[model samples]
Target: MEIDQAGKTNGQQPLFPTPSSTPPPPPPPPQISLSLKRLLTIVNCLLLCLGNAGGPIIVRIYFLHGGHRQWLSAWLETAGWPLLLFPLSLSFLYRRRSNPSAPAVLITPRLILASAFIGLLTGVDDYLYAYGLDFLPVSTSAVLIATQLAFTALFAYFIVRQRFTPYSINAVALLTVGAAILAMHASSDRPAGVSVGGYWKGFVLTLGAAALYGLVLPLVELTYSKAGQPVTYTLVMEMQLVIGFFATAFSTVGMIINKDFQALTREAANFGLGETKYYLVLSFAAILWQCFFLGAVGVISCVNTLLAGILIAVFIPMVEVLAVVFLHENFSIEKGMALVLCLWGLASYSYGEYREAKEKKEQIASPQVQTSAV
Candidate 1:
């Protein structure tokens, strides 16, 4: 019998029972194996590292290959903001088609304001980073950017109430010391065509960029917490989309004010690698940066802000090595020592996390054991 007819025949009973009368549905199966998920996370993290380290290297290469337009390069790098639309659009399409009744992302005025502020900060940070890469060798710039770990820790503690264990403290101190040693050495061994003053200028700008971004990461975490929803990939992408939109807008304004758009034709014509290659490099750089952004956000959502910062810092050594091989930049003994210190700091943090997790597991098991004994 049809559901409606059965209900009518049964008088007060409905053929299609109310949802409350129905048995709950079984939970959905896991989308992937645990091991596969972990492997994918590892791959994503490595890609994040590559994109973070490689973007600057590409900019450095551009300059080396007669691309003197620093502002233009920076603006082009911000193009990744638009590329974010691809993923965001697909996510929206999937959700709308598959689960149209799902709650839409809450877009409060406060969220909009926060995202706009972050976008403005990101634009400034990008320009400063580009300025640093333009003036300093890739190796020096990488070491300097590693200082962001210390700044991030500081911000996370104050902003997000993140704890600072002995190991974390030690890690920060070692990273700070390593960066200082590298900066001290930067002055004397300036790269060809780079002046002592230029090196210092770049160092200051890079340091500023690092500090700004340090604050930005924690702020992002705080925003997510305030969003009043369970964290999901779609939500994360939504936040990134908003931030990228305003960031790109800010950069576009800068390009216009500085007339970089007008000079694009001349820069392209004079580019050492020709117009096609120049555009290709910029395009690749933008895409890689989007990967870096997505990876960082994914890590933050899955882990915590501190681990994201540590992962970036840990990859500094690899970036330095890549710089040496690809850019032919010098790798000094001091840099070698700095690399060791950074790795040591990373290991310390990892050990601390391991111990803490083990202790938590034991604590949870102890109560069960006691109950079973009784």
Candidate 2:
């Protein structure tokens, strides 16, 4: 943050750090093209939608089809990380082609460690989610997952001092209430073949997954702020690669310990979906989960963590409907009410953000207009 008479910092400022009492930032450099930024943002949103809508449903498909290894399911969540190397390598090649003097790798050691730690936590989150999905209906799980936005907002406020408008406060209340309403009749809609004890365990585990993931998103944004380098989509992908690797490794250890690797063949042979479809389901689950991480990180890089959480919440209903249509999971009246309330909450938060952004734009414009007139 050092500056000379030129009024420039010694290095590039990290992307989107929270404002402090320090002096105002120097004008932002012309970094990525605005059009490209928009395009990337659009692409990332689509990826987010794909993951949020498909990931749980696919993971549920595995469980519903007689796949019962929690570690295996968690492993699939990050196993497709190898898919990232293709683009990352190309980014390296492009960097080399464009600037011969630039470093071949963009990842820093500190960032690696940070990403690794988060990845470990992500592994735990994956297990919690998988455990919940084991017993809870996907429709039930989806509603609980939507409660994540409230947790995200809470964490964001503490971590980034994110300003909360009335709308967001209302959202937090509604989302919490929606989740609570589900809790009131948690045993009433238990999936067949699941005991009441198992149902409660799944309910608690799913909420734990939601809360942990809520923390993870804000932490990812915090990492970008402290990354000490320009945050770009490529760099975000690089960080994601590291996170995925570590998370997969963590789960791999569990799979080894639990003998899940050995159980896969037996599970596949007896899979209700058939052996061929079993492998296909696992493959799709891995790829889709990777898409989920990619989109989540990409959105965090493009905007902020809460927006990413909002995007995830926005797709929860889609996930719920998909669960009903594809998995034929139970969809009860309570779930319907929960979905309605969660959607109402999401809409409130979105409008609040839009309203704040518009007002801030007008304020900035008003100052410039007054200065010009003077």
Candidate 3:
């Protein structure tokens, strides 16, 4: 018999006696390489860039080509959520390969609830955005969307304790100015027949969408932090899937109430772009907006919400280009100057991020070098 650390008697003596109360330290969190993180970040950034550039253009085309139902357009944003299953299936395959006994689902009930709440908010944002698009030009809406970065920063600071550098501040200021530039002459670039009140309404709605979405981003980051389960990329995708389903459901309810579903067939039949093109545009909207959201969450999982917002703000200028080339929009001198300022701000932010990363890498290397010298 031996006395254990807890003052309990052990009936059987062991070859090596250890104190029962001396428990082993918990396992450390998994360590991923910075290079791998950067790679994933780049891939997600590319996705965000593509979706940001193409998604809005596709949706704008719907309105320009005779789409009149805002709820229908909003529905399309999350309707393509099922497309995430392809990648999720791949993730499932890898998980089973790595560990045959792994559970079918990684996300917990808590994460699902959080994701659903956020998805509801996303649904509201979707409607606001779609309604805004019905009246505003894509370029103007995009510049307004750029203001999301400012809101994202403000919310992120409080939500996730995000710290900003001077460069990010400068970027925010420049983009704020760019958005304000449009406000100065609100009526100057109004589409042919959009009424003064209607344009202002769109402006306010889009700004609301931007601010709401800004809050949404930080909330998402907070969810990731609080999710009881380890937040893997696959789990992040699953959460996104849940979010999309709820958002689509939210819009579906609106579509029912507004009779947008009944109007869909009629609108499709008489669309300016032809019935074939009308359906095609809807299909594209579904796919493109899914791309936008998946990319957004992917970026958040890889890094933080701030970077995701920054990436979005950086590429809005590209939307202006697409608006001019494909939609034949009027890109005025004011927008051109705004474009330059936006680019300049993005450049500053990028340089700052690069410097910070470099400093961190050097700091890590110095410790290893000192150890090797010893």
Candidate 4:
């Protein structure tokens, strides 16, 4: 009877294991909540805006207070970039000890060389920007920098294969028009201390700075995409560290060659704000500029180069407002129009993003629904 019962149970078992013996399905992969991601993006954008706006203001204040140390300021700003090293070091140690087989943060010498080359360009870019700001009002400099958005869009299209929807086209067009208006009207409201010749020099230099930075943004995107591995925040920061190291090295050489380092002591002693405040201003400016650099790069990693450029462009008006309040610069009618147009372009881009996201969600959901129905 027992053998008969065992045979009956075995027959019932069939070819598959019983439910109790079957293994459970694996857990779903971890993911950041959509809302959290959006919130983080917003926070990063705000920080980027604030840092960009404030860095210039601090430098302007230094100059306003009779600080003629252009090279010093530029060097300090580039020098602070090494602050990224601490985090990068931690990442390396963690990866080595915890995940011995994981890919190194930036292992290839060719990649390092490429990043350093970009950093050298960035160092030159920073000096030009500083040279411009030394001669131009903060408001005018901000306007010129806005031109970077157009250049960034152009480069992104060619280099990254970023597709431009009609909305993005409209955004780019409007932004360009607004910048042109600003440039045309730029001569009308020269700051009290600046001369016509200086203004033009500043204008040209600032535009050059913008163009170089535009190239930098797209090239960064290209480098990461070509990395042959998935890019992460750690990798992004590591790239920044490499770039910063090279940039700082270049600037340090410039400082030494120009004897800017030798003049630093005398400049500090003769500073209008006194020696301590003068050093403080330089320190703060350097740190703030690094913050802006990091924030911009972070934004690029999180979104795209075009979006990062747009965010910077959008904040130009805020920088203008700040210039008006603190630096006593003019806010002409053209500048007002520029601000309005920037807002409009931002809205259009945002709407396009929303539509694209919606379509993607629908596409993903449709497949699931069809499978369930079947």
Full-model lDDT for every candidate:
0.78, 0.86, 0.87, 0.82
Per-model TM-score, in order, reads 0.85, 0.86, 0.90, 0.85
Q: Point out the worst 10-residue segment of candidate 2 by lDDT.
A: 12-21
Misplaced by over 4 Å in model 1 are 1-44, 103-109
Order the candidates by lDDT, highest first. 3, 2, 4, 1
lDDT of 4 by residue, 105-175 (tens): 65467678878999999989988888888888888788889999988988898989888888888888888
Q: Which stretches of candidate 2 lie over 4 Å from their true place?
A: 1-30
Better-scoring candidate (TM-score), 1 or 3? 3
**Evaluated with TM-score, which candidate comes out highest?**
3
Candidate 1 lDDT over 1-374, as tens digits, reads 43454454434566566556868875552355557656656766876787887887778878888787667666655568767667667867776787776445535677788878887788888888888888888877877788888788889989888888888788878877877777777666577888878878988998898898898889888887787756666667777767777777878887888888898888889888899998888888887777777777677766678878887887777777888899887888877888888889888988998889899999999999999999
lDDT (Cα, 0-100) at 200 in candidate 2: 88
Per-prediction count of colliding residue pairs? 0, 0, 0, 0
- Candidate 4 lDDT score relative to the true structure: 0.82
* Prediction 2 TM-score vs. true: 0.86
Residues 19-40, model 2: lDDT tens digits: 5537876554349987898899
| lDDT, model 1, position 55 | 80
> What order do candidates take by TM-score, descending?
3, 2, 4, 1
Kindly list the per-residue Cα lDDT of model 3 for residues 1-374, writing each as its tens digit.
66676554677445555555477775554676878878877888887898889889999999988888999989999999999899999888887997787678888888889999999999999999999999999988987898899899999999999888887788778777876775565567688778999998998999999999999999999999988657777888899999999999999999999999788889989999899999998898898888889889989988789888888887877898899999998778777777788788778888888888899999999999999999
Model 3 TM: 0.90
